[model samples]
Target: MPWKESTTMEQKIEFICEWRTGNHTITELCRSFEISRPTAYKIIARFEEEGYEGLRELSRKPRGTHPNATDEMVVGGILLLKEKHKLWGAKKIHKLLYNDFSEEKIPTVLTVHNILKKHGLVSPQKRLRRVKPIHPIFDPKLCNEVWSADYKGKFLMGNKIYCHPLTIADSKSRFVFTAKGHYKENLASAKAEFTKVFRKYGIPQQIHTDNGSPFGSVAAIQRFTRLSYWFIELGIMPVYSDPSHPEQNGRHERMHRDLKAACAKPSAHDLKAQQRRLNSFVKEYNHVRPHEALEMQTPASVHEFSTRPFPEKIVRFDYDSELKVLKVTRNGSVRWGSYNWVYVSASLQGKHIGALEMGNGIWRIFYRNVFLGFLATIYHLGQAKLRSNLI
Candidate 1:
């Protein structure tokens, strides 16, 4: 005789009434009620404690508030800060909360986000799916172990001139070295800005960049542009993200999102004014902003200057004694195996490279210490033809 689902309250009341008669034993009553002994005894205990009211349906709702519930005062602080900095997210707000409240009083980043979401203040953004990192070889363990540089997409200034922003940042510490504004993204402008960076911060061992003009060229040998060659001359290896894959340079890209929001929306009237804005952004980004990756510390607090200073004179590559060395011709061709001119790359013109014979007809090419590609000397119809396979 289990209690009917539709009339549980009536059945419970009837059982309590029947139990009070004392003629039926608790076990006998339990059998009659078709309920377990524990359940029967629980109902009996509730009736004794609270009388008829206890026999009525007990509230399934929880008692009082949860012990771990967030305080209304903290929620008020988060809402106030959100209204103050409309663009900022929970992490930044949480960091700012430290100014007014103790660490114990402040909510976590997730908690702040949840509060915002509950209040309908947070708009859900579509998550962009990312690809695997293209080059997993370079994992920078220290400051200046590597540095990333890229030209953010060009935008029109108030004076109608297109401003291209070239940004450079340390990979490990996330310190922005420079955010230079240029009329165009060309070799001269890029080189000048980099020279300033190198002189100030010292040169990094490796510089990471996207496969684009001034930094790289897919058509050129080993994707080396003239700027890249200059880097090699100064003992800095130039690395590139895979073509069309922006996630490989995700940290730098993330910084660009902030930069765009802060500076580019309502662009400054002129290049000089825009430059001032950029300078302000650099100062704020390095000193004021707290990075979650750096344990809520500013980049300036984490970054250290690179040890490799800019050299006064560029050092020439010293090749192994066994390998044959050849200088690239003015026309970008290297004379290989008697009269056959192998076109290496126009970018490599006037540069000396070494060739080590790997096997039968394939020769391994080297520009400085970097492996350029394969140089295969093929003979067809009694005529020897040199084919350059540039990586």
Candidate 2:
């Protein structure tokens, strides 16, 4: 028959007590209990040293060695350090402890935070209350499929005028498309500058920007204001960030911060001088600076220009094969097979409209030469038909 097992520490202590009081010799007890001599001796020694109390489990840590191990005090000090210095993550805190308390064994960051929680010394992290989570809609499998563009705000030069810089970066390679601009922040000026860039680097599939008035407008999320409208006319999709969330467009935002830190100095003054400074910095940023997110690779090293060439004359499609409709007014409102509907602009009016067969229940609307946009069949069929016989 199998022997009964000792479940609790007290039962084990009683068994040890029986052996130590001469019920059995140490070596014989070790054989019966299937324990080593050292284990048997440890139990015997513990019982002798503190009577029955020692037989119970006690912390193996030495007493009075760490004079400053109070949980509340340690957590308090960490909070103080975090508040005093702008730096306060685990790695930073570890470095601080190493510098300040060389003789003490600093606890891990997890341990420090646990202590803080126990004493309620730390507050919960502040999070944006009403912001929607942004997921990256397009991850370019190839370099240069998409590029992000924006003006890195403006800075005053020594001449007291502001320099508005327009920056463009490849979404995949993080290669800078361009980083030069003057005080001119208008759409026409931006278009001219981007035209030059497109000529050199070729056209990208899409370009992303914030909803700033220069790039787009809050009133119309899909309608291209001016800079974006031109791109759409040229076959490039314009992507816009969510309103009020700068980090949704993180790459451009990060670059702007770095540019401000590097270029905004005491001596810089007018727009021209600032442009010169920006040119120099762009060279360094593209070729020299290592990006942590890119595995320390310089942006230029990984970036490749797109293969699509910029055509001198914008290409126009014909409505020969499909159903055609003439938009009668400049309001972008149009008359289709049996339905009257509004569209983006008159750029497609007076031009033949073509319907391209897409997936199940989907169709693309096009003008004499350009793709206007998409419309759902259910919604497109709901409009009243206009007849010539109705006067």
Off by over 4 Å in 2: 1-133, 327-343, 346-391
Residue 356 in candidate 1, Cα distance off native in Å: 2.0
TM-score of each: 0.75, 0.56
Candidate 2 accuracy as lDDT: 0.68
Root-mean-square deviation of Cα positions for candidate 2 versus the true structure, in angstroms:
13.0
- State, as a TM-score between 0 and 1, how close model 2 is to the true structure: 0.56
- lDDT of all the models against the reference? 0.87, 0.68
For model 1 the local lDDT of residue 377 reads 74
Write one digit per residue (lDDT tens) for candidate 1, span 1-391. 4566768878889899898888899889888878889889889899899987887776798899988787888889999988976667899888988988888878788999999999999978999798554664467999988999999999999999999999999999999999999999999999999999999999998999999889998777778988998998999999998888777888899999989888899899999999999998999889978888899899999999888999868986799997899999988888876867778878888889899998888888888888888877776654444444632
Q: Who wins the TM-score comparison? A: 1
Native-structure RMSD, model 1: 6.7
Residue 351, model 2: Cα distance from true site in angstroms: 7.2
Clashes of each: 0, 5
Clash pairs detected, candidate 2: 157-269, 157-270, 158-269, 158-270, 317-369
